[model samples]
Target: MGSGSFSSVLKKPETTSFIILVLVMVGFTLANDRFLSPLNISNLLAFMPELGIIALGMTLLLTAGEFDLSVGAVFALTPVSTLLMVQNGGLSLELALVIAFAATFLVGALNGFLVTKVGISSFLVTLSMLLIVRGTTLVLTQGFPLNSWDGDNWLRTALAGSFYIGTVRIYASLIWFAALGLLALYVLNVAKVGNWITAIGSNRSAAVARGVPADKVKIWLFIATSMLAGLAGVISSLRIASASPVAGSQYELEVIAMVVVGGTALTGGRGTIIGTIIGVLMLRIIRNGIVLVGVPGLAFNIFVGVIILAMLVLHARFNKSSERK
Candidate 1:
């Protein structure tokens, strides 16, 4: 490791986050010898992708000076909707999925419309959406888990199949996570959309005055976030071989925390996809470490809170320093 890299890597936020991730890995591995075990590592990989995918979407939304609290609701609603359409409405699995995603897209569009066209705050708009989507899901399922269809299909296999790497099983979701992460990275760093997002978040009035389509971009970002959440929901349901209206509870908070910890400014206009990926891994590793160390499950949230607070403090400090320079 020559430590020779681009100037961007020398920036404090990304550098510090990468350091913290390495330290967390080493410390957790030392604390629990099995933290590095293949089985546990494999399990973590299997489950982490769903959240990682959602966090990538959150990264984009936050960078655009907006957020989607309804993503968790979308994650829960989409898969359950698919299952219901297939099982109760007698639709093919593919058609059921299409309908479910269309519904999710409408939720996103509604959120965007309320925020942009109706002049509502994004937070309040998404919060209302959260309630609406979750309520609809509960009304449909009545708090019962939807049974996954047992028939073999290419969709299920493509979304959630596993492969062997000698003795370890590599999940399809992980591949999706990586692919989506890379795509997000390109969009955020290389595409014209990235510039539009950064400009809108940095200064909405100025961006609008300068001819950037602020409202349109924000609405599109909302749609993208919701669609990504839907995909995550599908992957999760397929992996577990079932769908539940209660899935993805508290996931909005988790994804936000991951994005913040990964060096994305909560205030918007700044983000790093690599840092977001590291943040996702860091949170998952901590949860896994807590379990391996025999800590009471009740204390898990407490640990997460402390870590999030500490990361925010560090990020804020580094941000100030960067401004000074």
Candidate 2:
């Protein structure tokens, strides 16, 4: 494709998301004047980073034609691992954090290895890993919340504290999210490895025939996804000052929804960091708006289901139109 065509195709996905974001902002603002207030807006933005980080990684994996259903479990375990290290394993906070992240990365690598090397379906492999990790956390913690590290001031400040911009709180994790988003964007758009990733996701068999190391690419993507989830978990744990085995129980769904809504194809080989960010923000705002409008918390799940269904329909129609053209 020529550069002009390529740029146009790239811009199309973001345009849809940008429009959705604008509509969401307008709808929420009309519903509640407080929605546009600096405090509420800042709070909304604050929740974006952790999910944004996970979604960024998940976007890459999904673009490569794989799914990581184990992310939420991995997320839950990271903080559990950190708590274990600090309390039961007698490690310092810093060392515990390192081990926590490393362990999550290793888990991700294991998922990748199983899917690529053992020739298992990515869905099945990560699904099994999800149960395994969750079960292990339960057995280790005996179904109780891990609460021994509440006094780590330095760790708390570094991982969970916010910087203020004239009274608006910008979280440390938000900074990490921005940095990682830029890095992921660069790797996807400007690097040779990004091409390989797109090739592998677009057509694994063709990628292999072209001498691309498909397995290696997949393994690394899995690890990267896991590391992002782990980091998010660690930050969340610090912010909450405790680790609960069930903390991230449904987070995988949220992240997947964010990616899909952001226009990342479930079939892979198509997505963008900017779209994922917009998708994440849109979902967050919808959830927040539900609360602001006094919708029952339980009813939000129904709303989410409806939103996902609508997006899927739109995606199918969009793809069909593109193919016809």
Candidate 3:
């Protein structure tokens, strides 16, 4: 490749992450031939989209200098509420969906209001929201798993159904994830709103002074973040044909880790949808690989720590090089 081409490739934020993903895949495959087996690959793809959808929303929040810790709980809350309404309240599925998502939207709006209007820290506000939402879900469902779908519905199928191609499975959730990811990429890189978000994260007061509706944009992003989480939750419940009140209980931290490891700054002002995708895949692959290779699942986070550290170094080097040029 020409020097210019090489430089351009290196400058792309996801390059190192993609390289690491390939390395991890190869390493795991070498360790256990099953890593690349059709069963394992199908399983990985089936489960990945749940987290992938959440990570896309997180990328936007991080890029805008904000985050919603309540997403994990929202993931559970939305679907559980929808299913309950359908089963117990005798509501139509479509109406149940609208009501459930609207409730989730209200949660997001309240979170934004507390942070941006009430002068509370986003972290504390969202953390509190997490607990509140989780508690509400538990109380509503009495800690039981919601009933599964017995009849076929196009919406449910579109959200979570799967079909096999020979021995390989293709899931509708994966399709949803990819479609949303492409949309997110456009929003973050090609849209004017994206620039406004970046500006707010880079310097909030300055962005406000420059005529960006910083607070309003943040509120909308918060809503978007929660809606994405809810969608993921709904998809997840449909995939298993049941919604657990405790589903996605730990997803908040995992999504944050994926975003950070994918090259998004924890403190915000920068992020990449493609990098988040790589991060999500890398983490899931490592998690799957560990279990297959006889490593205890408890040690999974150890690998995550090491990978995060390595990514930090890699990103720093690339950034330094870019600055020099």
Candidate 4:
């Protein structure tokens, strides 16, 4: 009976992901003592929230049977717009932020409109957006970094400011990630809309037959996702005091990997906020660990690619086995 219980526990995808995360942490710590050092840990925590904020939204979209390929471009584009307005357009910072976020919301609304109303596949719609937004960002900046953040504002500091706890430094972005993650957790597990999202992902026809407002829910979700991505970008720009045209390039795949490896299904219908958080830590630790172990920084993607492939295969098998049972 104990063995059977253990077997059942092992069958859970989130449990499997947690085990892998622990193994990686152990392996890295063994490889380099600094892996456990407070300084390295501080640096790792500092890098967590921007990517994390984006991933939280991606988790929701994926769980609702959708994807947003333009999030990466939006991550770059939103901040670029805000900075350009502040630096060159003579707009007040507060007004610039309001306009930038409003534009972000519109981008998501457009993607949702094309997918839900115009009958386009989410992939094709978002892929086209990815190119368009990325191109616009590059053309606006002419491929240069915008370093015109001349003065600090309370808003910037509130979003990404640094503070110390004993010897370790922390950022306000971490607080944002935590608060938003908890809200996402509630959305996935507690709310009526959560059930609606899962129902739509699991079986759209059935959900609609049962009176779920599939299109509206998905459209609102897209808007929320875009807002999250844009917010992360703003936080990152504030932290670094610069907006780079090329920032967040290729981040879509990485964020997806974090969701998938964290035990979210590629097919939608199921996912876990806690698991996704663990997945975020796993990848971040892996990146930090690889550098400590003397691996070339440029080859980090090699590790991520391999992990994504492995997880996809494992999950497919796991899902198939559950079906057979």
Every model's TM-score? 0.96, 0.93, 0.95, 0.95
Model 2: per-residue lDDT, tens digit, 1-325? 6998976674566667777679878987898899877798789867888888899999999988998999998888998988888889888888887877888888999999999999999989999999998888888789999875667567688768888787677888888888999999998878998888888888889999999999999999999999988888888888778899987897888999999888888898887778888888889988888889777987888987787677667767666767643
Local distance difference test values of all predictions, in order: 0.90, 0.85, 0.90, 0.89
Worst 10 contiguous positions by lDDT, candidate 1: 1-10
- Return the number of clashes found in candidate 3: 0
Sequence-dependent TM-score of model 3: 0.95
Q: Which 10-residue window in model 2 sums to the lowest lDDT?
A: 7-16
Show where candidate 3 strays beyond 4 Å. 320-325
Segments in model 4 whose C-alpha atoms lie over 4 Å from true places: 1-9, 297-299
Question: After aligning candidate 3 to the native by TM-score, how far in Å is the CA of 260 from where it should be?
Answer: 1.2
Using TM-score as the yardstick, the better of models 1 and 2 is 1
Per-residue lDDT tens digits for candidate 4, residues 1-325, read 9999887787878887888889889999999999988899889999888889999999888889998999999999999999999999989888999999999999999999999999899999999999998999999999999975857788988998989988889999999999999999999999999999988988999999999999999999899989999999999988888899889998888788889888898788987888899889988888888889988878877986787678667767777787753
**Which one wins on TM-score?**
1
